[model samples]
Target: MPMSSKTMNMLEGLVKDSSFKWLLGKQSSFDEEIEEMGRSPSAGTNWIPELSPVANVVVRRCSKILGVSANDLRDSFKQEASESLKQPSLFARNFLEYCCFRALSLSVGVTGHLADKKFRRLTFDMMVVWEVPAVASQALLSVEEDATVSLEAFSRIAPAVPIIADVIICENLFGMLTSSTGGRLQFSVYDKYLCGLERAIKKMRTQSESSLLSGVRPKKEKILEIDGTVTTQPVLEHVGMSTWPGRLILTDHSLYFEALKVVSYDKPKRYDLSEDLKQIVKPELTGPWGTRLFDKAVSYKSISLTSGDGVPGA
Candidate 1:
């Protein structure tokens, strides 16, 4: 349903008070159009023309860059800038950012956003410069001047060229070329930079692997009888001087003490706490429930074992 007169008035008032107030600066295209509308009332019932000068320019440039029609570009921009009623400046910024992206799309001949690219490419301070070796420069110049490089592939390869400069820079061929290129090698210094990057990545991978292996500690097997079905469960074992940090298992046949360690190459040393010598020092202990539910509560346990009698040493 169309907006009622009262609702329309309220919306118009909101737009006039918020965005329109900011848009009507000292002198603008809108003001000029308003003056023109007053001068020529018979020109059209609408005050603004079908195509404003600014819109026309944006449409033509953006369409040409994207290989689309001016009409299509205008329609797309209008659809994207629908938020103009709420915040006109926000719509303006969106249009400008889109135009900037379109310019990049034109240069690379790829019509897509940064998220579409396979490799990472970031513009710092809106400036991207690379000093290539004479050989690399010659290789770049050999390509057809009209050809455009894919932005997706350019990060791994070369921008506006087919050469894989990143991979080439890591090769011994680059070192040989640099040595022969005289003092120009200093200006064309990419090998050492790439080598440093390679070393950093290798070191990161090594540390990651070390951390992963370090967490793989020794595990002890326990036989469980659940619903008359026997199942073997692997319980993670630890090794440390303090027994407070590790798990203390008490079975009908035996009492076991497993030490916790940061890294374990062999089976964890078990100190036998004799079942006969075991006693419930504290009958029951209280703690917070693991599930943290109001209905449930966790149990704390304390068991002391006499080591002087016949307890097997670790």
Candidate 2:
């Protein structure tokens, strides 16, 4: 269902009142599109580190910069990360995909919202093929609605484009103070009824052709299997962290949002969190049931309509 025009207009007004003019200055395409949408534009751009293949080069460089043996670097990275996030090669590759995507999208003037749209489109395409249910944990299984389908529903359908979001939150005070911080990351799989950064990846992937991501939630469940028989495995992990390099994986959106706010606005405490610089945020995945539900709610809202541009989601 399309959001009422009035609601959208109101949102646009909010963006205008507290304008990020700097973001606008950096994103001409973004600005024009918003204008086209009959909305106002912010100036400042939300600058996130680009996830690119070159990052593989960068990680290698980081390894060199840290002055550690190559083998040691890989081992330490894995040792510090969640067992759920142990695939160094895949994590590097996906990070690179994220890098390449922003670079490519930047070339086309699709910064935040536009790029976010691309992510969703790609996620949807993956769902059609993978046949992964739109739900993740038992909480997502529809209760009021029940249905019986045949084995044809179990036909060996193709897999989703091995896409997953491992949302992590950095800035664990205790870890930073004690020089022990790492991501307690959560991974979520997106399908039709399910939605998330996958929506953004789905769109971006269509335009870029990179596999986005897929998978689950807490109690340290690293193994995911449908029907409790066959299963897929966790492959990615935080690759490296030390005293100065700390990490925290977050599955919670509100906390993630708060972290983003604190990092961006609370400058006095920036150094306090700097110990968290080596962090990876699976924000889309990190948090309580409420946070996870918010993520699901976003997906639920996203499925109700087809957006041509922008984060244009519900």
Candidate 3:
């Protein structure tokens, strides 16, 4: 189902609010408001107090989008939260995350919304708020003021692409986030990654359609990760005493290695990943001329192959 503009607008406004006290329907005096601001900068930032009244408006809408009742959704969140020790504030924050994650997961599936700037920004803000979701009244005043998201939050929103189309993986998303933002996820870096992922998915779809039209075997598996450098970080594939530098691509069903032939790449060799093969993939030592001098490669071995192939760390 298409997400309503009103729903998106409401979410956009909700996340943009630095404080959620307004949603509590509480009217405070001028002095109380000033005092609240004078408290720890991180205090009351993570959760909204007295959230039950607003559930009809906020959580209910999200539950509707998910095709679940509001009470059922709340119960499910509580059940999940109960798996770990649950505090009042933590429970509330987790509930909010549950709603936001489910709703965003649905909304992104709508056409042209996955790469929308507002959607990206809203998701990033949700992540930021999720990182510190709890009223920390005694939080240190000297805490860094930098606004950044964390790996935990990134994992929640990043996997949507892979789950939807398998265009990327969690590791690839983390790599992009860390490479650009230096381990701290900023909105700009997050948005750039999403845009790139969208483009890659589109390109892959076009390629699949073209292959089908040309009477070629359509790509049946989704690309999981591609790692290689034409000139710099060469990916080495080792067989016997010989090694060839190439680009490695992993898919849902197999691995493909395209050897670098001077200024171009040779035809890719496919290695199937199947249950019947009894494949064993593990980290092993590899180096020049069959010497096991460096422990920086992954070894792929199966009963069907005489010699296992090793791929350098990606």
Candidate 4:
């Protein structure tokens, strides 16, 4: 049955409620606001907007028109529901899109239903599948017609692609997975400087090879600590503690440090941004020796780099 004029007017008020309006205006896009609900910088962003706190009249009337228990919608399911309800079948996707659009357009008197002719026609022609793009193989995404894949199961096998899955399945049809390896391999702005430092080091090593032929004992070789191709110049160089005062080299891919002295034997400590470099924070400048703080040192310019995740000093 179609909603009465009084009922439609109440629905309009619910959408315009101060709390809901605040949420809608907080972000430039619905996807940004919804996705960052739990993880946004502000502690208050974690607070989910509840339908119950609204005027009781609005809640009762909107709930009755929507044909769902108001109590179910009132709970703090902002994170869980936004995540789980993300990857529903095409039928469910269409149903949700219609509902959201209908609710937003209530002032204009638009109405919809899951059993509508247009929705039913789309559902009939659809193939309910999880199209994951990481493996680039047909087996990765294709879902069998009778197969039922839960959100929990999908979370385990492809934990990295949850955000993408949420966006696509909620909107409709399919989603693509970005290459995690490629994301790591991407270089930063300081790459060119790192590459120059690397070339200079190589040239110095070649010149020193002549000394090895002479009677003079050759210096111990410094080991390469990181794997994968790094193409960048060293924009920042410092001495930091990795068991000793190690030579710290900051480049596009990693923060690398190693002791040049006999104690460490040129074995370097490497912290690759690809592995777990979440955030860099709380930098401090300090001294080379105990209680003797320097404004500038030969290494690091007296600046100490600190990582939020407790990566060794660099």
Candidate 1 residue-wise lDDT at 179: 59
lDDT of each: 0.32, 0.27, 0.56, 0.31
Using lDDT as the measure, name the better of candidate 2 and candidate 4.
4
Candidates sorted by lDDT, best first: 3, 1, 4, 2
In model 2, the runs with Cα more than 4 Å from the true position are 1-110, 113-119, 131-164, 167-314
Better-scoring candidate (lDDT), 1 or 3: 3
Please provide, for model 4 over 96-191, each residue's C-alpha lDDT reduced to its tens digit, 9 standing for 90 to 100: 233333332342232332223332222211211122211222232122223333333233222222211233353221111113322111122113
Alpha-carbon error at 239 in model 3, in Å? 13
Candidate 1, superposed: residue stretches over 4 Å from native: 1-73, 85-91, 99-208, 211-314
lDDT per residue for candidate 1 within 52-72, as digits (tens), equals 322222333444556765445
Instruction: Please give the lDDT score at residue 288 for candidate 1.
Output: 26
Q: Indicate the worst ten consecutive residues by lDDT in candidate 1.
A: 222-231
CA shift at 121, candidate 2, in angstroms? 2.6
Which tens-of-lDDT digit does each residue in 1-314 have in candidate 2? 24456535534553463245435453222233333333322111111112121122223333333454333544555566565454543444333233333333333343443235444433232222122221122122111111121222212111112232211211232122223213211112222323543364454344311011111233332212111011132111111120111111222221111111222211110111123333332333212322322341111112222343112101
The residue-by-residue lDDT of candidate 3 on 113-160, one tens digit each, is: 756775665566556555554435213111122457777767765555
For candidate 1, give the lDDT of residue 106.
Answer: 56
Clash count of each predicted structure: 6, 65, 0, 10
What's model 4's overall lDDT? 0.31
* Model 3 ranges with Cα > 4 A deviation: 1-47, 50-87, 137-146, 160-172, 209-220, 223-250, 255-270, 273-314
